[model samples]
Target: MLDLPPDLPRLRTLRTWHEQCLREIDRAIAAAEEQARAEQQAQERRAAATPPPWMVGLQDITGTPEELHQGGCTMWAHRRRKTVTRDQARELLAAGIRACEFCKPDAELGFL
Candidate 1:
């Protein structure tokens, strides 16, 4: 067991010091949390500013022509993909880029 100091002044001083340390620690944690929140908001804004294109075409490993798909197609989960504009998608389709069987980009583009 720890022995308590008989002098009240010393005990009061120690309590005050402990409280101040705790307050400082709390302030530091709050500042770190605020910084994290600001960073996440900035990232969200950047993502919103440059939204993904409406259409995308998955390319082969060699970056050669491959299947065309919509932006949210499931086939692209494991495939390499690149975003393309609507006109570019049409051109790629014309260039024999096969439409994704799942998303059916051809029907969405009124090509079907």
Candidate 2:
């Protein structure tokens, strides 16, 4: 770094520009945080809605395809879910869609 002259007036202007850049960065960060919160609220609303009766269980990489859980089953919280109509549920079960033992969706569908 080069030594500046003692009477250099550029120092004040540079400091002002730096502060303006910092303020803009802070505003952008706040906007991003607000957007994230809004998205989270929307997701929560979707989760609160009543789930369909027949659900398909989500499969994870390298894991077996587990049985589908009932809509109101507590185990649904830990897995991803897909909603299915009553008839579709029956068809799925008939086609070898396994039912969760805890929720026993097959029994709920009169299959068991």
Q: Give TM-scores for every candidate, taking all chains together and pairing residue i with residue i.
A: 0.54, 0.50
**Candidate 2: Cα lDDT at 49:** 86
**Candidate 1 — which pairs collide?**
none
TM-score of 1: 0.54
What would the per-residue lDDT of candidate 2 be over residues 2-112, giving only the tens digit for each residue? Answer: 665466588777778889999999999999999999999999998888676667776766444456777888886877667778887888788887888898988888998
lDDT of 1 by residue, 1-112 (tens): 9676889998999899999999999999999999999999999998886635445544565786588877776677676777788898888888778888988988888777
Q: Provide the overall lDDT of each model, using Cα atoms, as 2-decimal numbers.
A: 0.79, 0.79
Positional deviation of residue 77's Cα in model 2 after best superposition, in angstroms: 1.3
Query: What are the runs in model 2 whose C-alpha is more than 4 Å off?
Result: 1-48, 62-65
